[model samples]
Target chain A: MKRVKFGTSAAVLAFLAASPALAASDVCKGSDINILMETVPDTDALQAVKGDFEKEYGAKVNIEAVNYSLMHEKLVPSLTASTSSYDVLIVDSYWVGEFKTAGWIKDLDALIARDKVDTSLYFPALMALNGTVQGKTYMLPFWQYAMGILYRKDIVDDPAFQAAYKEQFKRDWRMPATLEEFAEVVKWAGKYKDMYGIAMAAQRADPVVMEATNYLFAEGGDFYDRTTWKPTMDTPEAAKAVTVYADLINSAAQPGALGANFDDVANTLKQGKAIFAISYLFLFPTLEDPKDSTVVGKMGFAPVPGKDSFLGAWGWAVPSNAKNPDCSWEFLKWVESKDVAYKRALAGGQPTQMWIYNDPEFIKKWPAMSQVGTALEHSKGLPIMSRSTQLVETFAEVMGSVLANNVPPATALADSQDKFGRLVKGDPLLK
Target chain B: MTTATIRAGSPGRRRNLAQYVFVAPAVIVLALVVAAPLLYSIYLSFQEYIITYGMGDFAGFANYLAVLSDDFAHVSWVTLKLTLLCVVFEFVIAFGLALLLNQPHLPGRSFYLIVLMIPVLMTPVAVALMFRLMFNPSLGIVNWVIGLLGIPPQGWFGDPSLALGTVVFVDVWHETSLMLLMLYAGLKAMPGEPVEAARIDGASRLQILRYVTWPLMKPVIMVTLMIRMIAALKSYDLIYMLTQGGPGKATETISFYAYRLGFRFLDIGQAAAVSFILLIVVTLLTLVLLRTMREN
Candidate 1:
C-alpha cells in the first residue's frame, strides 16, 4: 500500500508510514537493539538510514560492523557463553545449520506467526536453503546473491582490440556468451604486457572455493551428492573443473591472483587493471561508485558465462541469547516489509524480494540486475549441513594443494573427498 | 636442597599471617587469569565440545588422540621450527646490535636505539598489516626492492616455499629490539672485575666474549629465550592478518591451528587438546631452561 523509492519526492517519505507500528510495543519503543553485520554494502545502507530507523521505531539500533572473516570469531563466543550482547546477526547461508543445530539462533516461526508475515517474499531457494533447517525458520534471507561476470566495457569496446579480436577469432568481440568464450577473453586480454586479462579470488580460502564452485557447477557436478550428502569432488567432471580453475590462475589471471580474495578482485576491476572478474552480483554498486572506483560507468554485468553459479545469501537472525529479541523482531518485521525492501534497494543495499527486480523505475537504471534472477534459478548454494563450513576449509586445502603444491587435481580431489566425507559422516549431529 | 636464613629481628618459628595476606590478591588474580582457563581447557579436552552442536558426549582421550594425528602433527612441527628460527635469529642480531650500541664512540647511539625499538612499540596487528602490504608481489615495495637489486620478482607471503621464512623475518624484525634491550642491560650490569681481569690476562676481544661475556650473561639469555619462545609459540595476530596461514599452512603454528579448529571448525574439544599439548611442551621446555639457568 505504501512505497519508499529512493528517487521519489521527499514528501512521500514523510507520508509513507500512516502510523508507526513499533511505538505500540512498549518493550521495543525505547529499548536498544545491537546488530552485528558484515562490513559490506548492506551495512553501509543500514548506516545511511540509521537516523530514520531510530526515529521511526523509537529505539537505539547500534550496528557493529566487522569483516566477514571475523564474524564467526565474534559470534561464537557470545553464543557459547550465553552473553546477550548481540540481538541481531547477519549470518551467511552456510551457517544456518550450525546455528540452528547448536541452538544459537532463536526459531523465527514464533515471530512469523505473531506478525502474520508473508514468508513467500524471498526467493524460495534461498529461503529453503538458507533460512530453514529441519523445516524450522531461523533467519530471513536479507541480501540474497548469485555470482556474475563483471568486465570492463570501455576496454572491450576499444576499436583496435575489438578489430583485432574479430580478425583473430572470426567473430565480433562482445560479452562472453559461454565459459569457453569467457576464457578466450581472459587469455586475449592477458596478452597485453601491462594488463592482466582476468582477476580471480583464487586465494586458498573461502573465496577460492566460492569461485571454483561456479566451475564445478558449469562442469555438471557438485561438491557433494545432494540426497546422500557424500562428497563428489573426486568425480571426473569436478576434477576437470578444479584443474581448469587452477590453470586459469596459473596462466591468464593477474600475477598475485593466487593470494587475492573478492575485495582484491573487485579492486582489480575498479582499477581498470583487469578486464574481467567473477563474484557476487552485489559488486556492481562498488564498481559504479565514482568516489573510489576508476572504472565507474565503464563496466558491464552478465550472468556468469557458465550455465550455473553460486547463489549465496546473508540472512538476519536473532541469537538465542539475544537480550532484546522483541525489539529485534519489531525491527526485522519492519525491515522485511515491502516498502523497506524497496527502500533498501534504492539506498545501495540488495533487496531479497523477487518482485524488486521487476520495478519499472528501478529496471530503467539497472536492466542487467534482472539477469541474476535467471541465474539464481540455475545456481545452488553450498551443501546444506551443520558441518558445511568445514567443507570450505577442505576446499581451501585441496585447492591450495593444487595451486601451491602442484598436486594433480584428481589427487587433490580424492584427498578432499576423503576429508570432507569424514567431516560430514564423523559428526554425530550430522548423523 | 637450599638453606633458609632468618632475617635479623624477625619473629622466630612463627607463621607470618600478614605475609599470606599481602600475597593473597596476587594468588587470586593468577588463579582467575591463568589457572582457571588452564583447568577449563583440560576439562573440555575430554569432551566432544563442538559449540554449535550444543552439549557434547564424554569423548575421553578421543579428542586428544585427534590432536596427535593428521594436521596437528604438521602444525606442531611448524611451531617448533618457527620457535627455533625466531629465537636463534633474534638473539644473534639483538646481541650483535647490543654490543655495537654499547661502544662508547658511536655517535647518535641513543637515537639509533630508540628508532630500532619502534617495531616492538607498535602492535603486532598493525605491523602485520604493514608487512602484508609490503609483501604484495606485484605492487609491494618488497618485490620492488628485489627487482632493483637485479633479482627477479618474488612472492613473499604468496609463495609456499618462502611464506614461512617471510613470517619468520617479520617476527625477527619486530622483536629483535626487545632482545637487544635485554642483553644491553645485561652487558651493563655484568661485573666489571671479571672483564678487567680477562683484559689484564691478554685475552683477545673474541676470546673474552666467548669465554667471559657469554657465560656470565647466561641468566639474561635464559630470560630472553623463555619470553621470546613463549611469545613465538603463541603468535597469531601477525600470521592471521598477513597470510591467514597460507600459501597453504606454511606459517600455521600450534596456536593458529588450534584457533582454526576451535573457532573456524567449531571443534572446541580437539582445540583444547592441542592447547594442552602446547602447554605441556612449553612447561617441559621452561623446566629445561631453568635447570641450565640455575647452574651459574
Candidate 2:
C-alpha cells in the first residue's frame, strides 16, 4: 500500500510538473487530494472528520494546518501563482470579501444548488454573515463565535461586594450595562490587591482589532459608508470609543495586559488572577474545564456590555477552489445538523447551530453553554467591505496610539479615517 | 610538431581551469539560493502584492508608495536611532572591557572571558524572552529588586518612554560579547614594541591607549563597527520576542515594520518594497565604510 501510494504521488507530481494549470476536476480522483486548513482549537474533532472523509471518498486528505498567524503568509504566494497547492481552504470570515474580490476563490452557489444543500441548519446570524455578499451566498459558516464578558462568579456573588457594588453604582449589581458602568466595575475590582479588574488581549494583531471592533460597535461607529466607500470611524462617537478602550487597558486592566493575546487572557482568567475578561464565547468550555482551569466552577459568562450593542462573531465557509466541494459541502451541512451540533456540544465543541442552543441536555453538561448561545442571538458581525482588513488594522493602530497617550482620540480617529478613506477610494473594487 | 607542442602545454592553465570548474558548483548554488530570491523580491517590490490565506494581487509601484507614505516612516526613524545608539554604546563598552582584559596581570581573566561570552552564546530568542519576563511591570524581578531598594517599580517595557531603552539594554547584554571578542583579539595581536616605545617617550597608559593602541586597532574597530551596525539594523528576533514594536509603535524598527506589513498585514508587495529600501540604505552605508577603509 505504501509503494502504491508513493507511486501514485510521484505520478501526480510528474503530471503537475508537466501541467501547472491543471484544474481540480482533472486531478482530484484516485486518492490524491490536498486540503489546506488553519489549525483551530478543535483539532481532535477535525481529525475525526478527516478520517471519515478519507474512508468515504477513497482519497487521501492532506491537511496543512498552520498557526493562524502564518497561514496567510503561506497562502498569498500560492494564490498569486494560481497553483493548486491546496484544493480546499479554511479561511476566516473577515477575509471573504478580499478573497472573492481578488478572484482567488470559486463561487460555490452552483455546487450548493446541485447538492441541494440546506442553509437552514446553520445559525441564521452566522450564515447571514458568511454567505451574503450583496445578497449572494458565497461561503458557509462552519463554526460561529461571539465576544462576551467572562467573569469570576465567586467574586460577583460575595455578599459584602454585592452590597458595596450596589451602593456605588446605584443599581442591582449584575453584568455592566454600559461602558461607563463597566469602567467603574473594573476600577472597583482593581482596588483589591490580589484581583485584576480585567484582562484583555492588546497585542498588535487580531486581538487588538477584535477588541477595538467591540468598542467601535458599542459607540455606533461603522467601518465604511457602504455607498460612498468612505471610512467612517473618525466621528466623535468613534473618538470617544477609542478613548474609553485606551483608558480601560492602561488603567483598569492587568499590568502586562498590553502583551496579552487571547490565549494569555484565557490563561489569566483560568489562573483566577483576573475578576473579568472580555473574550470570545469559544473559550468558555476550555476555561470551565476542571482539568485545565483552576477556577472551573468560578467562571461566569455574560454578554459584552455595550454603549450600544455587541460587535464580533466567527463563521466558517468553504472556499471556491475546493477539490472536494461536494464532500466539503456535505460535511458542512452535516456539522450544522441539529443532531450533530448537539453531539458536538456534548463533546465540548461550542454549537453554532440555533437548535443546539435549545437543547437542554447539551446546556446541562456545560452551564455556560446557554449564556454563549444567548449572547450569539444578539451579537453583531463585522462590517463587510473590500478594505475591511486595512480598516481593522488602522483602527487598531489608532486605538493603540490613543491608549498609549501618544495621540488624542479625536486626532487618532481622524487620521485613521483619512488613511482608510484613501485605501478605499484608491481601490476600484471598493469604489 | 602539434603533438610535441600539446605535450608541453603549461600545468598552470590546466590547474586554473580546474579551480574555476570546482568553484562553479558553489557559485551556481549561491545564485539559486540567494541571488534568485533577491531578484524575485526586487521584482515583487515593483508590484503591489496582497497575500491572503490563498489570495493576493499585483499593483505596480503602489506598494512602494504606500509604504513610503504609511506610518512606517516614523518606525524607520525609530529603528535608525536605535541602531545608531546600540552600535555606539556596544563599541565603547566592548572596547573598555577588551582594554581591561588585555592586562597581563589581570586576575581570573579566563573566567571573566568565559562569563562574558555566555550572553553572546545564549540563544537570542531565549534571552529576549527571559528579559521580557524579568522586565514585566507587575511581577518581574526588576520591579521586585527595585521595590527592595525603596524605588518605585519602573515600567520596564510597558512604558513607551522606557521600552526602547530596555530593549537596547537587552541587546547590549546579548551582543557586547562579539565586540569584546573582536577587540580583544585585536589588542592581543598588537605589537608590544609600540606600547614600549610610547612608555619610553613618557606616555601615560591612557595616552598610549588613545594614540598608539587605538590607531593600530583602527582596522579591527572599523570592521567590528560595520558588522555590528548591520546586525543592529537587522535586529528582529530580540525586538520581536521582547516588545513586538508595541506600546504604540515606540519600539518598531524597519525590520519589525516590514514583518508586520508582509506577514501580519499579508501585504507582501509593501514588505518587499520596505526590504528593498532597507537593502539600498545598508548597501550605501557598507560602500561608504569600505571606501573609508580603503582611504585610511
Candidate 3:
C-alpha cells in the first residue's frame, strides 16, 4: 500500500511537469506532419517559408504535391482510411461538402475560437465557398483563383489595329462588356494570320467544365436549381452558353484546343501564338516569367467580359484521423496569418485575404490585382455538394461532345441533365 | 500389423504435415493479398458502398444494373475496337520484324535488336507523355514535319474521328516491341528440321513460311496473342496520360470507365460492378483462347 501511494505521487509530479509544454503552442515541437497538397503557386509559396515554421516550432513538415487532375482521387483513399496518411488535406472549394459530410476533416470552430483566428480577414466568397459549410468552419482559405481575361496588350493597343477595329465595327475598340462582344473580339483577333484569337482549355473532364462554367454563369444559367434540387443544365440559357463556348472553340481557339488544359493555354499565350486567353489569374506569374514566355511584357489582364466569373480556390484542413492534429492546426494558423499571407502574395501566389489585396505594396506591384479584386466580389463558385464530382464530370463530357462531335448543345445538355439528376438524387445529403 | 509397418505409416503422416507447414505461408499470403480483397470487392459490388459514407444497404444487382445502364455499351465497343486493332496490327508488324531478324546471315542483327527493344523498355506513361508532346497540333515536330509536305495540320489526338486511331498508333509503337521480342524468341526456339526439309523439297521462302514455320509456331503465336489481347483489354495508362479518354469519350475503354466511376465519381459499388463485368469478359476470352490452344 505504501509503495502504491509513492508511485501515484511520482506520476502526479511527472504530469505536473509536462503540463505547460503540452498546453503551449510549442506542443508542435518535434512533431512531424504530412500534408497532401496541389501543385499550385500557393503550395510553392508555402514550401518557400517552411523553414521558418520548422525553425520556430522545432517541427518537421512534409508536403506531397500532385497535379490537379489527380489530387481528388489521391486524397480519397487516404481520407477514407480510419487513420489518414495525410495530417493535412488541401481542400478544393467543391470538396467542402463531401469532406464535411463524410467527417473526414475536423470541424475547426473550436480550434479557431481557441486560437482567436480572424476568419473575417478572408474574402467572404472564399470563406463561404472554400471552408464554411452549413454555418460550420472546416477549413482555412489558402489561395483563390479568380477567372479573368488575359490578352496581348501590344496587339490590342496598337494604333493601326485600333483604327482597323473602328472601321470594321464602327465603334472604338475597348474591353468587351458582354459575352457577345467578347466573341466578336475573339473573332476579330482571329483574322490575323500569325495569331489565333483565344487559347481555350477545352479538354473533356475538368478543363472544359471550368472554362464553360464562365459562359454558364454569364448567360444566367446554373448547373441545377438550388431550391428544387433539380438540374437546370437543359434550359435555353444553358444551351446558349454551351453554343457560344463551342462556337468560340471551333472558330477562334488555337489548334488542338479540344485537347488543351490550362497548362496548354498558358503555353499557347506564352508562345505568342494566341492573342488572348480566358485564364485564371493564378497563371499571371507564369505568363510573366521571362524564361518561358515570349510575350512577357506584352500581356495585359482584365476581368471576364460579364458580371459573373468562375471562382477557383483551395483551402487547408486538418483531417479527422490526423496523428498530429495540434501540429496541423498550428501549421494552418501560422500559414493563414497576415504575415504569411503577405509573403505568399509577394511570392506571386494568389491571396485569399481581402487585406492582402488592398495592401499598397501589392497594388503597386500588380495593377491587375485590382481587377482581380473587383472580379472576386462578383464571381460565382460551382455548386458544392457530395455529388459535385459527378456533376462536373457529366457537364464536362457534354461540353466535350458539343465541341468535339458537333453535337447540338441542347441535345447533349439535355442528356447530361437527365443523367446528372439521377446521380444527384442518390446523394444522401440531398435526400 | 508389424511394428515396422506402423512406424513407416507414422513417418508418412509426419511428412505430409511438414509439407503443409511449408506451404501454409504462401497460401495465407495469397489469401490475404489476392483472394481476400477480390472477395471483398465482389461482396461490395452487391452493397451500396459509397466511399464517403461507409457501407450502406444491400444493393443486390442494382449496382450492376446501374452501371450497365450507363456508358457500358459505348465503352465496351471502344475497348473491343482498341483490343482488336492493337492485337492484329501488333501481331502483323511484330511477326514481320521477327522473321527479318531471325535470318542467320542478317547484317547488324545485334544493333537492330537493341534499337527495337527501346520502346519495350520504356515506361508507358513516359511513352504517352513523349508522344503527346510530339503530336501537339501547334508545336509538335510531327505537325511541323507534315507541314513541309503541304499536308494540312491534323488534330491527331484532339479530333474525335482521329483520337482513337492516334491512341492505337501510340499503343502500337509502345507495345509492338515486346511482341517482336517474344516472336523472335519463339522463332529462335523453333526446330530447324522441318524448315530444312521444306527447303530441300524446293519450297519457296514464302511457301516455307506459310506451311512449315507457321504450323510449328502456332502454339507460341496463340500464347503471345492471348497475352497481348489481355493487356490491350486492360489498357488505361496511355489513354490517361495521352488524352485522358477525352475528345468526347472517343478513346474511353472499359478499364478507364471503371476508373472514372470509382476514383473520379467515387461510386465504389458501381465501379466494382464494372470491374466484375470486365473480369467476366476477359475470362470468357481467355477460356476461348485456352480451348483453342488445347485443340491446336
Candidate 4:
C-alpha cells in the first residue's frame, strides 16, 4: 500500500513536472481546493508541503491563514453559508463542539471506518478533544499544542542560583514537581534584577484564561464539574489555583504581564529576560531557532507542575458544504500519513501523531519530544461543549478582574461559578 | 391647452422617470449592501440567534434587556468616556495646530502638515500595534524615553488605571490629524476680512478668536465633531489591537462589547441588540448635533 501510494504520487509529480498539459487519471486533476488554517507553525509546515499535494493530486491548492483569535470569526461566515469558500478548515479544539452542533463540519466516522484509518495513532487528548464530538469523529487530528513550561536551562541550572535556591528552600533546585515548588522557583528567580522569573501571558479575555488553566488543572479543579455539569470554580482547590496564578502574574511575572499574550511571553523568553515561560510544546522550535531566539540551545521543556497543563490543538475537517470533500479528505489523509507527519514535525510543527514523538530521529533532534509525549499524555483540554466559548469568555472576565482589579480569588471564583452555572444550566452535552 | 402643450408635459414626466431609472442600480446596490444587513441585524436582534446553535425562537426584547442588564451599562459608559475624551482632546489639539498652521508666515508649514497627517494615513491597527510596542512597560522605547526624565517605568496599557487613557492617547494620535485637516481647511476657507476687521478694531487675538473665528468656525466644528464622535463611538480595531478591551474591561467599548458577544460568546442576538443600541445612540447624538448646527 505504501509503495503504491508513493509510486502513484511520484509518477503524478513527474507527469505534472514534465508536462503541464499532461493530465493524470486522478479525480483531483485540475481541481481547485481552498483551505482555511490558523497561522501557527503547523500551518506553516503544512503550507511548505502544499506543493507536494498540488503536484501529486494535480490540483490547485489555496491556503488562507489567519491568527488563531481571528480564525473563528473568519470561518463562521464561510462555514454557515449554503456553500463554503473553503473545502477544509483547521478546527481548534474549543471550536469542535460548536462546529459539530451547527453541522458546519462533516462527520468523518464513516470515512474513517471505510478507510480503516488508525485513529489510535493520534494523541488521545487531541482525538478526544479536537477530532471527535461525542461518538462521532468530525475531523482528523492535524497538530497538537500540549502546554508545558519552556524554561531557560542556563539560568535555572546555574550553580549559584541552584545553591541559593537549595539554601533558601531546603531542597535541591530542579524542575518543579508541584505547584508549590513552581511558586517557590518563580519567586526565587524573580528576585534577581533585570530578569523576570516567568513570562506570563495574562492578557485579559483569552490569554489570562489560557495561562490560568495550568493552575486550574494543577489543583485538580476544572471550569466546571464535567460529569454533573456544575461549576467547580468555587471550590477551595479552584480558589487556591486562582490565587496562585494571580500571584505569579502580579508578583513574579515579567513587566506588563497583564497585557502579555503568547507572542509576548515567547519573546520575553527569547530575549533572555525571563527565566521561565509557560508555553506550548509547539513553541519549542521557534525557541530553538537561532535567528529568532537569543537563548537558542539553552532552553528546556517540561510539563507544568502537578503534571497537568492545557492541551491546545487543531484538527483538519471538511466543511459540510465543501466543494471538494473527497479532495479535502485525501489531503488530510496524505498529511496525517506517518511520513508527512514526521516531515511536518521536522519542519517545526507539533505533530498530533504520538508515534512521531517516539521516532528516534525526531527525539534526537527535539530532545524535549519525549517530555512532550508525556505532557500530551497527561494534558487536559477545555471542556468541549457548544457553549464552551461562552464559558471561556466568562472565565476570562473573572480571571481578568482578579488579575487587574485585585478582586479576591474566592470572590472571583464564586462569581465565575454563578456565571458558569447560568451558562451551563441547560447544556445538553454535559450529560 | 393644445395637444403640443400636453405632449411637452408628458416628455418632462418621462425625463423624471428616466432619472429614476438611471439611479435604480445604485439604490438597489445600497439597499443590498447597507440596508439589507442592517435590517437583517435588526431582525436578528429580535431573535435568539446564537451563532453556534443557529437561529432559535423569537426572543422579542429579551436580547436587548439581557445586554442592557449585563455589560451594556459598563461598556456604554466606557464608550461614552472614550468618545468624549478622544473628540475633545483631538479637537482642542487639532484646532490649536490648525490655527498655527493656518498662519500665513509659519515656518515649515507644509512639512508640518505632511508629518501631522502621517498618522491619519496609517491604518488604525498598525497605529495601535506601533503604540502598543512603544508603550511596553519593559522593552518599549517610550518607557526608556520617560526613564531619561527621572521617571520610573510605568505599565501603560497593562495597568487598568492607565489602559483607557492610554487608548485615548493612541486614538487622539491616530484621529487628530483628520480633525486638523478639516479644521485647517475650514480656517483657510474663512474670509480673512472678519479677523482683519476685528484686528483693526483693536481686538486682541484671543478676543478675535473667541468672537469672530469661533462663530465662523462653528458649523465646521459641529460637523467635524459629529463625524469624529461617530467614528470614536464605533472604534474597535484600536481597542482590539491594543488592549482587547482588557486590564479587566477598562477599555471595553460598546462596539468591542458587541464583538465579544457575537464573536467570542456566539450570542449574535445580544450582539445585534447591542449594535442597534449603539446605532440608536449615534442617531440621537447626530440629531442633537444637527439641531445644534442648525441653531448655530
TM, every model = 0.90, 0.83, 0.95, 0.93
Number of the candidate with higher TM-score, 1 or 3: 3
lDDT, residue A304, model 2: 72
Candidates in descending DockQ order = 4, 3, 1, 2
Model 2 agreement with the true structure over B163-267: per-residue lDDT tens digits: 889999999998999999999999999899999999999999999989999899999899889989988888788877887787678888999889888766667
lDDT of 4 by residue, A19-63 (tens): 756543264778887887776788788888888888888888888
Error of 4 at B160 (Å): 0.9
What are the per-residue Cα lDDT tens digits for candidate 4 across B50-93?
A: 87777899998999889988878888899999999999999999
For residue B73, give model 1's deviation from the true position in Å.
Answer: 2.8
Q: State the weakest 10-residue window (summed lDDT) of model 4 chain B.
A: B4-13
- The DockQ-derived docking category for candidate 2 is acceptable
Docking class of 1: medium
Candidate 1 global CA lDDT score: 0.79
Cα lDDT of model 1 by residue, A1-431, tens digit: 01332223224223333346424344567778887888788788778776766888778889998877888788878877645588787779887777777777777885687568888888898898767877888888899767888777787779988888888789987777767677777887778535777888877578888898888887778877877777898899888788778777877786667777788788778878788777877887888888989988898777776667777898888776666666677788877788877877877777788888889877766655778687788888887687878878888888888888899999988877778877776554455
Over 4 Å off in model 1, which ranges? A1-25, A170-181, A192-194, A364-368, A426-431, B1-14, B144-154, B196-204
Q: How would you order the candidates by lDDT, starting with the best?
A: 3, 4, 1, 2
lDDT of each: 0.79, 0.73, 0.86, 0.84
Candidate 2 or 1, higher TM-score:
1
Model 3: CA > 4 A from native: A1-18, A22-25, A426-431, B1-8
TM-score, cand. 4 vs. native: 0.93
Badly placed stretches (over 4 Å) of model 2 are A1-40, A44-68, A81-88, A114-117, A132-138, A192-194, A307-344, A426-431, B1-66, B99-123, B136-155, B192-208, B264-269
lDDT of 1 by residue, B149-211 (tens): 998666677778888899999999999999999999998899888878999999998998899
Residue B187 in candidate 1, Cα distance off native in Å: 1.1
CAPRI verdict (incorrect, acceptable, medium, high) for model 4: medium
lDDT (Cα, tens digit) per residue for candidate 2, span A151-257: 88888999878888888778887878777678779878777535778888777656777876777777667676667766787777787777777888877776656
